[model samples]
Target: MPERSSGRRPAALVIGGGMTGMLAAAVLSDHADVTVVESDVLPRLPAPRKGLPQARHAHLLWSGGVRALENLLPGITDRLVTRGARRVPIMSGMVSKAPSGQWFRRFDDARHLNLVCSRDLLDSTIRTEVLRLPRVTLRERTELIALEGDADRVTGVRVRGSVGDGVLSAALVIDATGRASRAPVWLTDLGLPPVEERVVDAGVGYASRFYRAPASTGEDFPIVNVQADPRRPPGRGGIILPVEEGRWLVTLSGTRGGRPSRDNGEFVPFARSLAHPVIGDLLAGAEPISDVVTTHSTANKRRYFEKSPRWPAGFAVLGDAVAGYNPVYGHGLTAAAQSVLALKRVLAGHALDSPETARHIQRRAARPVGQAWDLAVGQDVLYPGATDETPGRLERVAAGFIDRAVDAGARNPHALRVLLDVMSMERPPARLLAPDMLFRVFLGRKEPLLDGPPLTEAERKAAGL
Candidate 1:
């Protein structure tokens, strides 16, 4: 272990070393000397760590998130691109099928863009940039066991490390641990009321594999997606995303009974069975690069930490700790990035040691969390047996509106722009409900609906399909 400096500045403790945790540490560094602790030793290279199994699956960072990352760690996107990540322009570089069963046109003009890469690469890149700050120190192979303060204010963290058990006192404590976060229990242990919580479990599952890009496709291929229709039973979907190293990461997913299997032989066949066969067609000639990996932890869960009437002053929760979105929406990274931006906003005006500061920060952090939660469950709840919670009139209305927007987006670039703005998180969810967007939806698709995947001759020739 490297010797860390103990400065005279105020100190903060951030639990977790994943992207969100690192982002929290980066932001907290502006106000205090930050100490980041994790149970697993973070990898030095762009490789998977035990704590993040989802790294093996396809991950996309939307423009909304990319912008937030730029604000958090300047030049991060450039660093990632330089390290082999692809900056894919929104609809222009994508071939997609909406839940309405219409294939989207590959519009050349796009209003937003996203970064696609292995989750490992994305985390490692940000990790490198964040750890370089003199005010932030990394303590790998350490676990946060509990909070160190009372119900009124959190003063630090108690942890178990390489040598023995210990305590790290700080002016503020942050929990960035993902879906497995124990903050709720930790709060309960502090004599605070349990945070209100809900889980809209779609019973979503993922099965992902990697392949060498087909020789004919060369180096560039549009991202191919087949979205599941919640309106139909057995919601199933798949996406073929181009990552670094001439690789395409194909992830197949389904709700409940429709789930994909981890058996390697079953992978492509499942892809073949989606709403459309584009993912299957693209994978037909591709060379396999890795075995199938599956995860069943893709539920939309939220801990209403902000709603707690008694939030401790020295504490706040961020990232997957507050809300975990289904990965198919690809909003996890984006939401996490924005949550940190939210944290940065709160920290800018508040003192680190103030309990009021922590409470204010928690509420602001929950804003993005709530946005992402609504976005995910809106569709997820429509899946058969996804949740016991009944969808009310508002849910039906929102779903219907989104359905029309999807219909419009398939052909109308204007409608697509509005949808993309919301999808990118560059704009609020209401962007989809704006008068202009509603007019576009009412106007309907500009071009005739596509009968099949709109693959260009060059793309077909390259794909050898």
Candidate 2:
């Protein structure tokens, strides 16, 4: 192990420089001088980098995530919009066909909103804001080698950077290295027990490409989505996200035998093969601007660190390090942001050197992680071969009720708001079971379901449909 100095400021060591890691650094900056160590030097502008392959795909920031960002860095929403990100109102700013085979009516509601932009743009925007903090220092090309302390506490970390191997001592250490985090292995080396983990994989794969937006599309162009039914085998789906710079980021996905292809020629065809052809039809008049990028590691995996009885102090995990959700649900960023917020809350009252401080942060962080994990895996586990263990009776009952809720929400704006409240992570999933929501779901009046994609005449003309 590399030798570490004993005397240092009350600093925090963040192990990644991605969005979540940056957010963690931003929060920790107020407590202590923070060091963000990254294996890959992040880009200074809104462009893709080697570390984040998913940056090429469509990423949505739900209202929950939007609020988290604003709370962490005030006026960030405006900064992103000034740089071309769109603050799209939920339901109204979307054209979606639910897995239940009903087209969601574009209800005139603004309570729920989503931030739409390329992942690169989102990352760069957040990174820029976080790095502006005087107390936060970013160490490029630095990689974590191991945790420095034992099972009782973590004093710092052994790391290898551009210069050589050494130790960065801190009062706290946060692992935010995404899905590839080595914390589990490092923990065991410290004589701590293995963390409980579960994985629900639907074998879903994705292929995404960018398109020059059709000339006539307005700035508020709706996001077009056709969702896959988990009850059906070889599920297929597609989405068209109107991102910054007048570009459309289109992503097509499928489970197991139906996965999309990386071939650029097959991108549009795959979109056409989804449950509905609206995504394909809209793309017909648009010109491709980038080749398709594909990924196969879409799985909902959770590490229950909070449940570990032997959890150590002075070390904590956040972001995908704690739980990596299926990107299809678009909850990863939101969950991570909320986890950082929880960390902020925990640190507000507790001293960094206090016993069980890391444990408290870890437990609070798990709250958002559990919410996101359930949402991402609820439908995934229903797919055959998604998991070894069968979903319990409660899960089955919940699924049935969710299907009914989706059906009702398609026809009733009130029910739709209730569903969006949960889906957007603005409220707990229990919100769906509230008395009023139950009445709306089971007995309230519902409008006639639209027979096709609810594209406005103006939207159709703009897409040349």
Candidate 3:
């Protein structure tokens, strides 16, 4: 953390006060005076707001992301857990149906875990903590109207507030504005060529609702997941994750024509219609607490800003502004957290006012984006009418290996360990190609695949199944 100067501190303008923006502020505050401008008036407590419609859905911080976030904000995980968020262990505390139509057994050994809670709580917790930093200022109900500088160097941002519009000059400007980011138009306005942008929309739609859990399904309840089989036309999936307040956040999803609806009547049927009927069965006995809320913008979109031949000195983009994944993958927050770490590392030794520094940060931040993008679009592109462009030779080969790996995971603990590693973002996809993992995938002795959901007798009784 290199302070810009002791006499006059360098300033930064961060657009969007969501999770990504908050993390960016936390990291930037270590190097400069940071200001976060948000269009919506943020709630003081852990409650939902107008800007984040997706907050209605469930959100989790995988172990890898939790580690990255912990590095940036110490005691953040304990803070979340103390506030009622559950740290659910992977595999051991999960009952999941793989796309290969095999129910993965709940192994006794757990390696990875994730924090499960409402997006509201996750955002609010980070917001409260990040804004308290000495040099961080939060501006509410402010709209970013335009970029302050030209194509070669970004000096600040022109924002419109309730009183009037004004330009806030800064040495660095971050666009953490999320999916609604207009960075492309903003850059083009500054005379820079548009960056390469790609969208791999599975045409996936999300339908989520909250439910009060059965009394017997106490604090230690397992997460129930029914994954969509991409091999099947119009893929569908659902999950039952226990969040704070002893309730479950159930989100059902479908691809293209098979999307789930907000109609209360169709909720359970969609869950029942998944590869496994377990989610629907569990929901049948649970009490509903919220109406079904639906969102259709679950596309995997990415802007390759780093590839641009010319990048401005004072401008950088992070989080959903750079790349956004399907919520079902649960990698958006994790990727953003990792991006913040990348930014912090880049700023450690580089001058804040250097264009090369901004370029380095942009390129490094996109590393996690590439990882999550490949993982998400690899499956999303397989959905019917997902995209017009076909997957390249490498993609097809990777997909082949993934299918075999999934089949291996269902029956083999060694294979399952590798799968969980990649799924939890602890390891890269190349880990599956390691010699030992390849040996297990090809020659390891396999246990019999499960014919149905692998729930214990006590677990079934608790859910009143």
Best candidate, lDDT: 2
lDDT of each: 0.88, 0.91, 0.89
Give Cα distance to truth, residue 169, candidate 2, Å: 0.3
Residue-level lDDT for 245 in candidate 3 = 93
Model 3 over residues 60-165: C-alpha lDDT tens digits? 8887898888999999989999998888887788888887687887777757878888898889899999988999999998999999888889999998998688
Tell me the lDDT of candidate 1.
Answer: 0.88
Candidate 2 vs. true structure, TM-score: 0.98
Better of 1 and 2 by TM-score: 2
Clashes of 1: 3
Taking all chains together, the TM-score of candidate 3 against the true structure is 0.97
In angstroms, give how far residue 336 of model 1 lies from its true place. 0.5
Score every model by TM-score: 0.97, 0.98, 0.97
1-465, model 1: which lDDT tens digit per residue? 222224567889999999999999999998889999999999999998899998999899999999999999989899999989988887888889998898888787746979989999999999999999999999988999899989888888999999689999998888988999999999999999988989887888999999999866865688999998888868899999988899999999998788999999999899999988778888888999999999999989999988998988788898999999899999999999999999888877777775588888888988777778888999999876777867889999889988888889888988888888888888888888778888888965489989999889899889978
lDDT ranking from best candidate downward: 2, 3, 1
**How would the candidate models be sorted by TM-score, starting from the highest?**
2, 3, 1
